[model samples]
Target: MNSYMKHGFAVAALSAACNAAFAADDITVIKIGSAAPTTGAIANLGKENENGARLAVEDVNRRGLVINGKKIKLELDAVDDQADPRQGTQVAQRLVDDGVVAVVGHLNSGVSIAASRIYHDAQILQISPDSTNPKFTQQGFNTTYRLVATDAQQSPVLAHYALETLKAKKVAIVDDSTAYGQGLADQFSSAVKSGGATVVAREATNDKTIDFKGVITKIKGQSPDVIFYGGMDATAGPFIKQVAQLGLNAKVLGGDGTCSDEVIALAGPAVDRLVCSIAGLPLSRMKAGPAFEKEYQQRFGMPVQIYAPYAYDAVMVIVDAMKKSGSTDHAKILAAASATDYQGLTGQIQFDDKGDVRSPRLTLYGYKDGKKTLLTTMTP
Candidate 1:
C-alpha cells in the first residue's frame, strides 16, 4: 500500500480499539438518599446536612470515580422529613423504594430511630450524620450507622459540665416529649443525679410548643443553677429568650440539637447563657475543617451549621465502601460500609460491631461575640 493508505488504515484500527474500550467502560448511576427536617422548625440544620451530602456527590462526580470497572455517577435523593417521626418513616420507605444503594441522613435521632427499621428491612445502608440519641444504635439493626457520638455519650458530658464545670447544685431539666428529647433528658437527669447533684424540677414540652412561660414559671420556683433543655435550636432559642425575659439567672444547657448558628440567631442576646454539646471536634479543630468550611460556604452560599461535615463524611464513607466492594449491590454496600474506616474531613470514621463510630468525640460550645466558642472536648 502507499504511505497515505497505510496511515489511514492505522488510524482506522486505533479508532476501533478506542470505541471498544469506551463501550466496555460504561457509566452507571448510583443513588444515595438523605432525609431530614427540611421544612419545619429546624430546617436550617436539615438543609445544612443535605448540603454536605450534595457537596460529597458533587466532589465524587467531579473526581470521575470508577467502581467494578464501570464509571460511576453519584446522585443524591434528598427528601424532607419535616423533622417528624411519621414523616421520617415515610421518607425512609420512599428512599428504599427508589432503590438508593445507600442513605446519608435523618438528622434527628428520633427520625433516625424511626426510619432505621425501614432501611434495615430493605437491606440498604443508612449512615446518620447527626442523630445522637443512644437508642438509634441500640436497636441492633445491621444497616444502621451513625457518624457522631450518641446521647449516651453526650448527655453525661453535659451533665458533668453542669455539675463540675458550672458548679451547679440544683438543676432543672426539660424535654420536648419526642424520642430524642426525652431520651437525652433522661440520660442527663440520671447523670446529674449520679454525680450527687440535685435535679430540682423536670418539665415536658412538645417540639412545636413556642411558649415556655408556664414551664419557666414552674422551673423558676426551683431556682436551678442551670436548666438543661432536651430539644433542638427552634425550641431552645425561645426557651433561652424566655429565660432572659423571666429574669432567670440560671444558665441554659442542651445537646447537639441546640448546637447551631440558628440558636444564636434565635436566642439573640440570650445566647450568652447558652451552652451546648456537639458530637465531634469543632469545625476549627478538624484538620480539614477550615478548608472544607470555606469550600462549602463558597458552594452553598451559607456557613456550615452543624453535622454538615459529618454528613459530608458519611457520604464519602458510603462511597468508599462502594469502591471497596466494587459493586452497588445493597448487601455488598452494607457489608463494606459496616467495615468502613475512612478518614474523612470530620475524623477517622471506623465503625464498631454495632455500626457506631468508635471512640467518638464531643465538644462543648458556647456562643461568644455572636459566634460559637469551643469550651472543651471530651470523650465519654
Candidate 2:
C-alpha cells in the first residue's frame, strides 16, 4: 500500500506541474507602446496620457482578453520623449525595435509628426490622442491615426467664438512656435480674418518661454479686444498672468492645449479672463466620460487631464482592431483599425480616409469660480 500510494502521489504532482506550465504558456502577451513627455513642463499632461494607456491595458487584462482563441495579456511599453521631436523619433525607433504592435502617444503634434515616419516604415500603427495638427495625418501614411479633432477644425471654432460671441473686432495672435501651437495659430489667424475680425498683431514664442513680458507688451499696445494664444497651458498660464500684470484688459483665448486645469493653477485669477477650446466633448458630456473619469481617478489617484480619456480610447481601439481582424498581425490590425466604428469613452470613433476621427466635436470652455466651465459645444 505504501509503495503504490507514493507512486500515485508523485505522478499526480508531476501532472499538475506540467498542466500549470502549459497554462502559463497558453496565455500570449502583446506589447503596445505609449510615448509621451513625462519629464518636461507639460509632464503632467504626458503622464496623464501614459496612465490612460496603462489603465486600458490593465482593464483589458482584467477582463481576460482573448483573440484568435488564445488568452491574451497586454503590456504597455511607456516612454518619455520629453516633447522633443528628435527624442520622439528615437523613441519611435526604439518602440519599433521593441516589437510593439502599436503605439499611443507623442502628445505634441511635432513629436507625433516626427515619429510617424518610423512607425510607418515599421508598419506599426500609431495613434496620437492629443496631437491636433493636420499635418500628422495628412502625411499619406496609413499608420497614423488620432482620436480628436484637428487644429484645422478646432481653430476655426475658436475664431468664430471670438468674432461672433465675444464680439471682438481686433484680435492678437501668439504662438509657441511648435507645430501644434504655430499651426493652430496660423489657422486661427486665417479664420479670424475670414470672420471679419482684424488680426492686430501676431507674435511668436518658443514652447519653453516663460517670460512673455516683451510679447505681451507688444500686444498691449495693439489694444486688441482678444489675444489668442496657441500653445500648451505651461506657457498659456504664465502668458495670461503676465497679460494681467501688464494691465492688458483684453480677453485671452487658447486652443485645446490651453484648455486645462493646469492653466487655472498656473495663471491664478487671470484664468478668469481666459477662454479655451477642447477638441472633444467635456467629461460631463461624454457618454462614458463620467465612468471613465471615476475609474481613472481611482486607479491613478488623480483627476482626468484633457487627453486621458482619448488615450484610453486609443488603446481600446487598437484592441478592438485586433479582435475584429481576428489576428494580431500589424497589417491586419492596421486594416481593421482603419475601419473602426466602436463607441469609445469619448464617443463614436470612426476614422475618415485620412485616419482622422470623422465628424469630431469641439467644446469651448471658460473659467468660472476657479474651475473650467463649458461655454458651448460645436460641430465643425
Candidate 3:
C-alpha cells in the first residue's frame, strides 16, 4: 500500500474505535416520577419538594451513580396531583402508564394514602418524604416507603407539649378531614386526654375553606386553652388569620403540614407565638443544611422549604437502593429501599417493619418576624 492508503486505514480504525466506546457507554433511562401538587395553593410545598428531588436526580446523573459497574444517569418524571386524592390516583396511574420504575412523592397524606394502592397493585416502588398518616404502610402493600416520621411519633409529641410544657388544661382538635389531618388529630386528642387534659371540642373543615370564622368562634366559646389544627398551610394559613381576627386569644398549633412561612405571612403579626410540630431538624440547623441550602438557593434562586431536604434524601435513598440491589428490577429495588440504613441530610434513616421512619427527629417551632424559630427538638 502507498503511504496515503496506510494513513487512511489508520484514520478509519480510530473512528471505529471511537464508535465502539460510545456504544459501550450507551444510556439506559429509567423514568422515576414524583406526584405532588405542582399548582394551586400548595404548589410552593410541592415545588420545593420536587425541586429537591430534581436536584438529587441531577447530582446522581452528573456524578455518575454506579449501577452494575456502569455509570447510570438518574431521570426524574414529575407530575402534578394538585394535592387532591383523586388526582393523586390519576398521577400514579399515569406514572405506571409512562413506565416509571419508581416514584418519590404525593405531598398530601390523603393523596399518598390514595395513590399507594395504585403503586402497590402495579408493584412499583414509592417513597414519600412528607405524608405522615400511619395507614400508608399498615395495608401490607410492601411498596410504600417514607423518609419522615409517622403521625404516631409526631402527634404525641405535640400533645405532650400542649399539656405538659405549656400547661394547657383544656384543648380542642380540628382537622381538614384528610387521612393525615384526621389521623394526627385523633392521636393528638388521645394523647392530650391521656396526659390529663380535657378534650373540649373537635371540628372538621374541608380543604377549600377560606373563612374558618364559625369554627373559630365556636372553639373560642368552648373555652379551650389551645386548638390543634391537623392540615396544610393553605387552610391553616387563613385559619390562623381568621382566628386571630375573630379575637380568639388561644394559640394555634399544627403538624408538619401547617409549618410554613406562608402561614406566618398569612397570619401577619397574628403568627406570633403560633406553634407547630415538624419532623427532622430545620434547614438552618442541620449540619448538611447550610451547604445544601446555599447550592439550592444558587441553582433555583429561592430559599429551601421545610420538606425539600427530606425529599432530596428520598432521592438519595432510592439511588442507593438501586446500587445495592444489583438490578433495577422493581421488586428487588423496592426490597432494597426497605432495607436502607442511610445517614441522610436530615438524620439517620432506618425504616421499621411497617416501612415508617423509626426514631426520626422532631422540632417544635413558632413563627416570629415572618420566619420559623425552632423552639426545641424532642431528641431521642
Mark the regions of model 2 whose C-alpha exceeds 4 Å error after superposition.
1-16
Give, for candidate 2, the lowest lDDT window spanning 10 residues. Answer: 327-336
Per-residue lDDT over 69-124 for candidate 1, one digit per residue giving the tens place of the 0 to 100 score: 78889999999999988999999999999999999978888889999999999989
lDDT for residue 132 in candidate 1, whole number 0-100: 82
Question: When superposed on Cα atoms, how far off is each prediction in RMSD?
Answer: 4.0, 1.8, 3.1
Candidate 3 per-residue lDDT, tens place, 191-216, comes to 89899999889999988877898888
Q: List the residue pairs that clash in candidate 3.
A: none
**Which residue pairs show backbone clashes in model 1?**
132-151
- In model 1, the runs with Cα more than 4 Å from the true position are 1-25
Off by over 4 Å in 3: 1-25
Q: Tell me the lDDT of candidate 2.
A: 0.93
Candidate 1 TM-score to native:
0.93
Cα deviation at 278, candidate 2, in Å, is 0.5
Taking all chains together, the TM-score of candidate 3 against the true structure is: 0.93
